[model samples]
Target: MQSIHFISGLPRSGSTLLAALLRQNPRFHAAMSSALAPLVSANLDIMSSGQEVSLLMEESQRPAMLRALFDTFCRTTTEREVFIDTNRSWCAKMPLIADLFPDARVIACVRDVPWVLDSLERLFRKNPYENTRLFGNDGERATVYSRMESLARHNRLVGYPWTALKEAFYGEQADRLLVVDYEILTKAPEKTLRLVYDFIGEPWYEGHDFDNVEYDAPRFDEALGIQGLHRVRPKVAFEPRRTILPPDLFKKYEHMDFWRDTAGSRANVLATKRATREDTTTA
Candidate 1:
């Protein structure tokens, strides 16, 4: 691959929208979450097992085999020169990616934690007839507290990406990360895309109509019993509204965004803060 990057971070945080916008560039190939990470993990387990067949494989060949797996999985026509793989788990696999492709970067799309949960709640309320596949078949019947608890648990939505992002933010490979705030992205897509292209060392391209981009997989959403869950509107404007959650619940995570702090590097803290001020003033 000429260029490879990973799109990860919090769920319901504009990852899908970012992928849709990136695909507008003919030179880039971007999509929703893929199965490459889980497939690679499974392959590692199978190869390292204590079975007799495992003894024949040398440790030196493992890296090549793993690299080949990604190369084969992401291979495409010559028209596409850059590939953006989307998966929330990629943040946790940053070390492995850095080791395999030293020049690869990760773009983390993030938003407020309360808003993320609220978005999920809004979907749940909208599709009352179908149980969301996110928390299994019983998601429809799950209470608000239960759903929140499940999301806050380790390896789940709020827990996994938050932990993994913090790890990458403070780790040695922090320079290889670009933290994109959802607020800024929706409010100023051109500026955000320019920043992204600059970070990736690619020539900036125009002609992307963020206002009319359509991104949704109806069949896939139907399979998950959550239609319109991944849908993005035709425009990129931010619609400020009241929180769907109770006051207490909304306040619980109102200050949960750690990227807003001054400590985290490789983030647009000032821009995010400015966005927050503008949002508040508009509200």
Candidate 2:
């Protein structure tokens, strides 16, 4: 039986890094988050086509729609032993999708909460899709970012729905379900990759080259286009090392240790006061 690995976690939790590393292995076929684009678009299309999809429909049935939508993916990968899909937020709907994969492994990629929010804020201005999809209009984007309370609430709400599944799945079959911390993964890529390979029952081969494993490089610009295929853009080469929050705003979120350790820590806080100091020393 073919197996599916559901790579999930909060957004900006290093799911991309984990997914990229997994894709380096020849036996693994990493689908990235694009696996669900068709299903999401199809659902929207159906609703737009005047077919009423009940919000109360049982979760089991949702997977049926996805099964039909992802049939092409399943067909194309008949030769592969494992098919992977890395969508951190998809954990919220795992019950609906897990039905399609009886022989699947679920991997949760997590990061410190504060770090997650810090990373999210960087994308706030550029992320137009969330404004339209979650909120009614793009005008409210500024409002959402301006209010500290609303931003925190939004972040919590965004990730809360997936917590229960993470608890239960990891609690019951700890080995089958993996939780990889973003910090550890990035700091020690080869070690983490070995653990992931072992979990999937794949042999570790020495002299394997991982330095130039191509990920979502081609889809970067395509992601900028709102229309067309709607491919989820992967990480790019350059990104801002830290987000600069206002003093008042920093004070509000300072209690989050993960954020403090990386961005708001004593060293970081002090460094900000001293201009020309090395801000990139550690985070």
Predicted candidate 2 versus true structure: per-residue lDDT over 1-283, tens digit per residue: 4466767655555566666666666666674565564455567456443456645466466657666656666557545666677664455544445456655666666554444555545455455554423333445345535433443553453345236334424343433555565555555657777877776667875644445544443354344331221222333221235545555555455433221223211111100111111112111
Q: Least lDDT summed over 10 consecutive residues: which range in candidate 2?
A: 268-277
Residue 170, model 2: lDDT of 34
Query: Ten consecutive residues with minimal summed lDDT in candidate 1?
Result: 274-283
The all-Cα superposition gives candidate 2 an RMSD in Å to the true structure of 8.8
Clashes of 1: 0
What tens digits encode model 1's per-residue C-alpha lDDT throughout 1-283? 5588989888788888888888889899888888887888887777786855568898878789999888888884334889888888777787888999998889998887777877777777788887677785365247886777677667776778888887777777777888888887888888998888888888987879987887888888898777776787778877776666776776676777777664756543313763221231010
Top model number, TM-score: 1
Q: Candidate 1 has what TM-score?
A: 0.90
lDDT of 2 at 80: 63
TM-scores for every candidate against the unseen true structure: 0.90, 0.60
